[model samples]
Target: MNPFLPMTRQDMENRGWDELDFIFVSGDAYVDHPSFGPAIICRLLEKHGYKVGIIAQPDWRGEEDFRRLGRPRLAFLVSSGNMDSLLNKFTAAKKTRHEDAYSPGGKSGCRPERAVIVYTNKLREIWPGVPVIIGGIEASLRRFAHYDYWTNRVRRSVLMDSQADLLVYGMGEKQILEIASDLHQGVAVENIQDVAGTCYRVPDFDYVYDYVKLPDFETVAVDKKAFADAFADIYLEQDAIRGKKLVQRNGEACVVQNPPAMPLTEEEMDEIYDLPYQRTYHPMYEKAGGVPAIKEVKFSLVSQRGCFGGCNFCAIVSHQGRIIQRRSHASILREAKLLTELPDFKGYIHDVGGPTANFRRPSCDEQLQRGTCRGKECLSPTPCKNIVADHSDYLSLLRELRKLPKVKKVFIRSGIRFDYLMLVKDSFLEELCKYHISGQLKIAPEHISDRVTRLMGKSNKEVYRKFVQRFKAMNERLGKKQYLVPYFMSSHPGARLEDAIELAEFIRDLGYRPEQVQDFIPTPGTLSTAMYYSGIHPLTGEAVYTAKNPQEKRMQRALMQYWIPGNRPLVREALRLAHRTDLIGFDKKCLVHPEKTAGQEKNKPRKRR
Candidate 1:
């Protein structure tokens, strides 16, 4: 068993190391698990015979924590953990979030806002000329100029703001190794700009070639049209096979991004997952009750990487790419067997999946050679004719896992593409109902309105309804009373009050009261975020109406949970505003009663006694 990476100088000495090759600074607590990006990168480096140390969630307010590990020999790798710092710290309403699952003790304020920029700035302050490389979800998604929801303005690429020597976007396994190799051979960070999946800034465009130049930061910052156009170009060119090198001028410097790193093969996937991960948070965190993030992934086996679901609101396409890269069934089973050997092993294996659990291979055969279609989605507005929907590999993997000894149940808790499932002509659903699901299967059918769903790049209401019917039929055949907990989003771009009301009526008809509702948050680097900011669809250039007002957003959210007594007022107001007062009445079909009717019931309540 391999010991955890050194976090202190004494650990370095214990390992008989005089100096380290790289020091990773992360916004999340050090979790030596594959689920955490920092851990995977650090461990991958260690596997390549390099000395790596971690400085997880250091105090940016003081210099002590930053100086603890001292300067590294090669570079300082930085990330804002698995999630964007702004999204992690705040809600859709821009309210401060009190709990951070990534931090120790589930406490907020462990990492500074815009953590990549902050941490990188601190590293520069302390280590002067040492190379600083930034990646992870925050830096990956913000590799190009993007709209900041909190600031309500277009900000330059994180590479420009953080001033990191290189920005490794997407999965960093491929990029990190190349960067490390070059740095080990004594290559200057500035000359390493040609590496794939990395972004570097140059003072001029002299050395840059064969790249698509995006709209200048100054223009995109002010002109919405330019912002939409630039985003459209950025979105379509994200594929690894056919993607183009991109460059955008940020004031005096031009940030040049190389083509994305190629997807890892099955053997590569196995090699990375097979690394000696402690599979939990570092022991130092035990005193703080352990990191809150590990509970979700400790037993979970990541069967695959990447998703082709292509939801507009998701950042997977931008970060993990659209192609699906999966581990071999043997690799996954090996991890499951290992899970069974753990001291805390319960009979249950929490989950066995990745971004989209059902996806085991590329969406189509052409994706490997030609890449995904530029502006067309595989399973969106409609499933493309060429789209290949297969679940045999995944189903077989699940069956093998179920047959394992000491394993009670294997659940597929990761988001499953119901639309894709509907396309498969197999017994996967039957098996899913019988062995995988635990009474309820959660699926994201963001909104019921086809008009709104179209903007969200999700399947229309008809497809979701058909899938629901099929799920019910399958469950009935199995004699199980399982339910589909359909997830709904409110106030997404192009959703008006009428759309929200339409969704509310659908919920009323289904007699489903959603315990939680997702209010659309316009985070950086999503197609929906671009639409939310530009009021125009980047792909089609269509006008989209987004609910930016707090009250309207509240009403939209309330409409989804109309059954709750506390939401009655907002639901009533939303109904009235949409000219949907017909839905507000003292009738069985009504979502809420009128104010006068409530008052009358209050006054006549004495009869109840």
Candidate 2:
């Protein structure tokens, strides 16, 4: 149940309900990714026969309204994102503040205020006896002290501040369902310790069976100072098999290094997508609506899961595992056909892609046979532990999607790994340029400097440029207007002012201007954040370059956007402050005299006839 939904708890009580079963809340817009977070838990509980509801974009006020819905014996689950927010402070569970009441489709560019943090604590204040579960991207990723990208160091764990009964990590569908099944049958939620991926506080410490363990989350009250101190040295290990200290209590913690939650098996994904949105298997989405009208819409679909492109700043591979799982071509076509029959089917399929869009099977099938991979984090220096990097089947799937008569156009909107795409055959590239040209293709080259790019585990920026050139040339020779749109990041650890300047110079040379610059937000459990916090490479555990604030990051970002003639003075000033004016323009000669640059000219340089 989305927590933001209006409630009529008293009406439900009058309808003869002794006690409510379960409730769910999320910060996500709640678009229904059924397999993730509350969506999964709700579906599983329904199968086991329990009344449930979700609250999306929750409102913390009117605590009485929530209690009036059912008796004291109830269970609640809360989530903020696809991953955990960086607010794990164990001794103190609830943040003593509330966020402004900005609804969904609102609140775009702003840091959450102290008020937003206190909004969730209202549940505990109102109904002290009910069981509350907080899991999801924000909770899971920040289950322990982790590097805070914005502030650039390990911060407190989230479990302490939110004070939920349980904080689950990984895919919690199965875990949460079993916990609820036992609870509805009258088992006390506190006694449910066998549940995997669950974090809670206990009365005393015990020897951890494996890497780490946690006390019941409820037992821990808010201790902001202790929580902050605990994470003072916390950071991520990019090459970690279990993802660095899977559990932490004060200074003590466990390292159950794991990757992305299990990906959808090809068969399972196929079955999910084929569900003619018109007639879903269960009443979950398709309640008896106004009519059996032709509800046809072209939907973008995920073709594979997990990524092995060990980019230090990312956590996708950590959460989803490096191995890619692909849905079958036939399965995709089946869904495409269903879309065509829809009343609104516009004969255009948005796209069929996932993580990298091109990678098909898990990276390494051979490694899978050898049992679990030792190299868990996909963002690593070594070749992916799962070596089965095959994309042919995926290419085939795209060809078939193009053939569907009802499908007028297919845009590869989900991102593509240009390096991997470059590996694709020339004919495939030509066809891709010819058929799949929805004007532009999106890719993440990250940065241009080789050292910085290598640190992020991304391909050389040169490769991306070449890829763009190939794409442009292929389309142009065919008289088609196609373009390459690359995504780049600034101020990743190891990216110093020199590197930023080089990237800016490269972009200037390419004659291609970026529409948007991605300012990195260090999510709770990412290696990049870890590297940023400790100034250490996550894999090698070696110290590396790092930046400490938004100002430094912003300057690096500005360098890319204002690389033309007019901003040379600004770049000079930034470089002087950065102590990186050893190169041209910043040399004493350029600094002493003001010379107008192409950036100042505005229009492209006039070609000297």
Candidate 3:
């Protein structure tokens, strides 16, 4: 049996010596993606002089792999998938096959929590006193509870149930280093409170600052549920969360819940970019007998970390930080050379960009680093709360990436912020059209309604229309066939029947039936989640619409994929349900059906307002 399978009594006896230095468990994902927990961590620890071995993709149903990797190690780190929605969407599908059913790995009923329960139990059985740590997008997003879309109610934090000695949230490079250092110095894992980014319970815990304190570990050991509940009920304390700190119950002794780690400094960020990344397949793909990702697809190198466009729906600002930090042209060229050397190298590079791709420098000159101009929001249709216009260095990198040998074509597959693109300096667009895009560009305009667009903080729908016109004129003048694959999001708060139908109508008029429409899923750690909770922007104090009904959400999602042929019945029923039966088949009479289009012309959603 594979070492990663179920553990048996023999498995326990087989676990070598019950002692080792570092045991790293990871969720399977592209190793090169910046957010990958295991890849970055394993490398970081090994850099600090630790013997690290990874057990990738351990089956919760089996314990053999767990047993093999088990040791009374310095520290044991656990990670679920890099994404939380990938896990939640997987679980949500089992309950509602009516909405698009998707799970993290696409297994029928495998949920994220089950991965936790199994791993925690196995770790306890094999190495009783050894510390077990949980990190990754799964741990970070649910660190606190804001809302539960599938159940339509607020729930407690995930920390209450995951059952790990500690939960490390966010990019954990520095924190994990501190953890390993503490363990090697002969400190008990429970004494790991000083390390930033770790959440644990200690006896008689109280921060020197004297705020809410953790329970004495005896209390937690005696009544785990009570301690878990204590951390979950903090409505007021969580609202003031800054970069990473432990949270404890109101008044408990001995228990210490270390907070998460703070953001990295410019110096640390620079160092991380210098880490060697050939950004390819798993080392054992040949013996493993599976197609590692590095085989068929090769993602081109681009920006390192950060996105200034703070779209509440996105996690980029929260996780990677909003300050755009870019790698130099020479560094990018080095990686490009390495990519070209790969045996499976293709003539094409998938993309070379980042959040709003065009942003290269931090948004402000040093003087106003603390804040931005109040009127800055007036610049774009949605004026992303975090938009930074960084283009100089970005353009330079683009130029260098296109000049590589054996690299016939370089594509900008990264999402284009259409609103920002329209304002691109004419010189930049000239370059953009000449060397980068491969005829088709992918951009997200999100929605058509000005009301929903602003609320979602997406660019105004009109800017998209103007952008489309300009793009066509440019292509025509250049005698080229370049076009955009504009992305749209439906069912955001403030979006109702009108907004969706308008988008549908636009799709039909343009004779463009998109293969997919992204219905918003409120992942953990996003401003979007906050808006869903309070129906207002977390940064701006303004009212917003919150979509709560499952059936309505289904209709909105179905509308996006309505062009898929199999979705026609659902689309028809939904149109009639919304009292816009005229759109059932888009007949000429329905177009004139007074009650479907808009205005006082008698066309209105016949369903429910």
Candidate 4:
């Protein structure tokens, strides 16, 4: 049977079903591709012999928009699409975004703010007593009481705010299936508490034994130190094997979090990938630019999942866990072959990696047996002795894909852990520079200052410097004129005015002006966000400096792009504030030249620090 889940009541009527077992509410236009979370969850439900329907990007102002599909027989599944909804609607500076790739026509404001909470609340208003289960990146990251960067304050768990019956965290396949099975057996939604990778609200914590109790919400809400302390404990206990159940009190009600779900094995991964995906947005969106996000991944393959890079600024470890799980080579090749048969395959495969491109296996052998260590990292300060730095499997997989009939090139656009790449002594770099690169290869070094880099849990600039030397050497040897586009961030926690100045100087020396620069966004689940909210390092509990002022943040961003004529005023003011006016003179070493006469500087640029 060709199982494409219905999106409307008439579609369900055509299939001889009176009512759907599940109605999935999404904040994005429905794309049936496997890369989309809502599509995968809905299809997985359908494969289990349940009727499922979708309500994608419905207007959330009142009950009229949510009434498209009446109500499901079992429950309603809610998600904020692939990316977090807040990140989709706003930039790091809290400015409203003008484009949403997940929406039709690349329009913005199609979804509500704090989408999961807003959608769930509106669902309850329309369909009273319908069980609501929330998942996806937004709910998963905010399952517990944590900071909310948008409001600049600590907020309770999304479970409490949204009033959803249950919350599924992490990769939700196993948990969602278990919930469905129990529901099919007539179990109440309120009683589904013991499932792994889930969270539920309770009247009290009396029945929850042997679970770690975080400081109550009230304490953490008012005390910065307490918030950091609670966050550190949560970070350490994310391991599936070593973690215990967690409990947190929010007034009279308590939130209980089950341990993370174990990673899927190769066979399980193969089954999930082989699920029938339409691999593009529904035909209904063809006139509206076809969901701009699909253009990046339409021909790409997902070779792996989960990251062991353990960067503090990233939430992958929290959401996907630290264990590295991947699909088999045969499985990926099958997907690539199917792509060649697609009408849109244009001889190029855009990407072939996940969270991190080069990670093919666990960082070390023991990770599968015993979970990742609490306070240690795989490749930040230094690579662990037990770390296995091999790319033979991934390299072989790429070689097989390249030999496919219609495939012309395979690129690795996802992040590449340069620190790990530098540790391996092989021809991988040469091959990457020669074949996989799309004109210019992109890598993230974040920042160069040792102080800021340490706080971000990234390797120091020395390691990045060495990698740059090797990358240049490899390109030279291969007789290719390729460029290294390094990603840099400004105004991260622990970065001072002086540090921003240091970064501006580094950009000056590199002679490369970045077209895009990211200001650190303190999304809910990451360690760096905790520090940004509490002004204390979660692991260290030490007070860290944060550039929170609006003008200061603009200055830091402007300094990174000092070459822009429009940004000269902000850059000059930033330099003066840092007491680095010596850099404003007309010298080769200076960032900006001194002021000159209108005629004398007509061709010359103006400097007004």
* Residue runs of model 2 more than 4 Å from their true location after superposition: 1-20, 29-41, 71-74, 82-120, 149-154, 204-207, 212-246, 251-264, 267-298, 328-331, 341-344, 371-386, 424-427, 549-551, 563-568, 575-609
Tens digits of per-residue lDDT for model 3 on 515-552? 65777776656666666655655445566676567777
Lowest summed lDDT window (length 10), candidate 1: 600-609
Compute the lDDT for candidate 3.
0.59
User: Which structure among the candidates has the greatest lDDT?
Assistant: 1
What TM-score quantifies how close candidate 3 is to the native fold? 0.77
Candidate 3 positional error at 59, Å? 2.6
How well does model 2 score by local distance difference test? 0.57
Give the per-residue lDDT of model 2 (tens digit) for 1-609.
322222345434454455557766655433333333445566556556676655544444555534545433558776764433333211011233232122232332112222223435766787678788777666666666554544534455666666666677655655676677788788887676656556665433453344433322222223323322232322332222333333455433332222223345677656555531322112322342311111121366557666767676766644554656667877767766776786766777776776677777655565344423553433333344334445667667887888888788876776777776655454667767777767787778889888888778887766777887888788889898877777788778788877887887677667768887876655666666656655656456566786656466666777877645555666666677867665435443232224556887786668999
* Candidate 3 root-mean-square deviation in Å: 8.0
RMSD of each: 1.3, 7.6, 8.0, 2.7
Query: Which ten residues in a row are the worst by lDDT in model 4?
Result: 1-10
Q: Model 4, stretches more than 4 Å misplaced? A: 1-3, 596-609
Rank the models by lDDT, top first. Answer: 1, 4, 3, 2
Give the per-residue lDDT of model 4 (tens digit) for 407-443: 9999999999999998889878988998999679899
Q: Residues 288-360, candidate 1, lDDT per residue (tens digit)?
A: 8999989999999999889889899999999999999999988888999999999999989989899999999
Model 4: residue 521 alpha-carbon error in angstroms = 1.2
- Lowest-scoring 10 consecutive residues by lDDT in candidate 3? 96-105
Question: Which candidate tops TM-score?
Answer: 1
The segments of candidate 3 whose C-alpha lies over 4 angstroms from its true place after superposition are 1-20, 29-35, 85-114, 146-155, 194-198, 202-279, 283-297, 366-388, 509-511, 533-550, 561-609
Which is better, 2 or 4, measured by lDDT? 4
